[model samples]
Target chain A: MREDFQDELTRVNRTLVTMAKAVREAMRQASSALLTSDHTMAQQVTARDAEIDVLYRVVEDRVYDLVARQQPVAGELRKVLTALQVAADLERMGDLSVHVARAALRRHPAPAVVPELADLFREMSTVADGLAAKIVSALADQDAVLAAQLDRDDDAMDHLHRELFSVMLSPRWPLGVEAAIDGALLGRYYERYADHAVNVGHFVVFLASGKDD
Target chain B: MREDFQDELTRVNRTLVTMAKAVREAMRQASSALLTSDHTMAQQVTARDAEIDVLYRVVEDRVYDLVARQQPVAGELRKVLTALQVAADLERMGDLSVHVARAALRRHPAPAVVPELADLFREMSTVADGLAAKIVSALADQDAVLAAQLDRDDDAMDHLHRELFSVMLSPRWPLGVEAAIDGALLGRYYERYADHAVNVGHFVVFLASGKDD
Candidate 1:
């Protein structure tokens, strides 16, 4: 029974890693859509979000099932609960990606990002992509060290987020209020996506260390 | 043993209700600070956020302890899990309130919200307060009917959120880009607070009905 339970746990972990990968790809595509104003890619990212939600549900049900069947205690139980949290953070990351895509769609036929802010958005996207990749590796290997580093990596995203606001509010900013609002909100989406990734990393650290610190 | 477990669950539910009340109060104060630019009130709201975070950690730890000690299964296990989720949502609501307060603090001496949008912000605050109240009652009573009503109630917040953007983007808008950005981000924070409240309501419905839908 113990061995069977471990097998199921392993399968659940694999699903989490797969969900992370899907979220990473979603954000990457959503960023491209926003920068290039590619309506099709933006729509694709929004549509594919359902798949990530489905994966989240899968993880949730399996964790509950494991709890009911095996009554896992102590460390094993913490591992299961952490899996649930990691999946939830990934699910939210997926939603944040959709928000970026929808922002692109909202300004369809026109560029969502202005030329002045394009480089900043590109940098934010790069930081977001790197954070998502780290989340994948942290979950797949249960590497607490890698997970701990996501916090520092997320700082880059935050820095870019502040820069986005500064640039939009600059006197030289030639864009109208509409573009400024779009830039502010889009920067928020990427920043939040990175925050959620860091949250997942913390859960991975807890799973590895069996301590909530 | 079963009765003892029931008593503990009741205590956890009460903690959740208390946490909800605290979050509601935080948003109320935060809104007042934003509209009035009352720096002291804003500081108080930010300072007290740590208390909400403490309550959230309490809920998390207690739920884990209950799971380990009792190994609750089936419906009871689901109840425990739902409690964890409800606490998490409430904790996030507290953070959203801080976001509003910080917006106010960032522009101290000058109102965070311009006079043009004051009425609209007041309305958003009212809706947010209403949502938080519903969350409290829903958790306290485990009233699925009341919980289900939150979705429709949230539409008011959504409408206000859209109106916020329209007001900022209007050709006649008198504010500069900084105020527009502030308005946009503040609106997003309030909208997300409403969304999290709705999420908690869904969890309450699940707890009462034994169905995820």
Candidate 2:
């Protein structure tokens, strides 16, 4: 209820949204690189991950400082602690984006997703971006509704991931072993990116409801 | 330090070890089931995962209560926060073991790993168990040395994972698409299981030396 607490909480919330945006951009660029075989874009996403780590550290320090100084118990404590968790989730979402980029980088000059499965991966990226935006809005507005919707979006991601698996497992699969590995792993990266976004959503719900679930 | 705080810290520490042991057992049994085609053991590992989740919640509640009630700062604060991080890592480690088990169960009546790759997965499981033991000991003794060694062990696990990849991508890969998916995913479960163990080690080092490396 303190004015100082309110100001600091707003700062944390702003930082979280900014961090989410950074990760969302990374995811988009990384997916673009994968779909288009843009080596330069992939490299950029991979290189930019260090900056995301710096943001993560900044959020962590702010959350810890809030707790150490204010010692806010009850709902205040939940809010402070959930900030740390949400920051971690966002940071990992950034890392998953980098992993997608790395997959592209690992097979440079050649796309990781085969022509047949490219559309599915493209859809996955779009869903991931949507979830990231929802998470940012959910955190900023403390909207548990938006946060919970991320799970449904994540379900869409999981379905795409499974579809990706079937492509690799199809009897008439044309891609070689290398493409199979790349596609499988690339699909997983996007799937995990969405999962982390959902995790942030759940953290927002926890912040709003004081429920760990 | 207050006596009651120390007592509660010890309780949390003990539950962490117990939880680690459960996950270790799960990892061992899951790997055994995969290597030996023991369906019952695979089922057991998957079934026991719920218990690990219960332990994770207990640790979370205790760590949060310690921070809220004790208002620990500085070193005490680091201890409480690191406890939370460590619990999350161990819980993920348990899930990874379940993943390994699920791999085996999905291929029921058939061994997931061919004779060629069984040895490598077995070695990975052994290495993971060794790392889990080191982590539990490090936490119990607060030994930075043991904690640091886990990263090195994790490197070994990664080496094995790369080796598994080479086998999957070999020119003469004997397995079909379905088997390849199972092998690749199972190998990853063990590799990632080790990675989470290393994460816990880093958390231990952070707790011991106040360095977040």
* Per-model TM against the reference: 0.98, 0.97
Model 1 over residues A1-213: C-alpha lDDT tens digits? Answer: 899789989889999999999999999999999999999999999999999999999998899999999888878888898888888889999999999999999999899998999999999999999999998998899899999999887988888888888888889988899999999889889988998998998888888888875
Model 1 chain A: ten consecutive residues of lowest lDDT: A204-213
Worst 10 residues of 2 chain A by lDDT: A175-184
Give the Å shift of residue A108 in candidate 2. 0.9
TM-score result, candidate 2: 0.97
Residue lDDT tens for model 2, B61-170: 88888888888877787788878778888999999999888888888788888887888888988999999899889988888889999988988998999998888889
Q: Give me the candidate number with maximum DockQ.
A: 1
**Which numbered prediction scores highest in lDDT against the true structure?**
1
TM-score of chain A for each candidate? 0.97, 0.95
Alpha-carbon RMSD, each predicted model:
1.1, 1.5
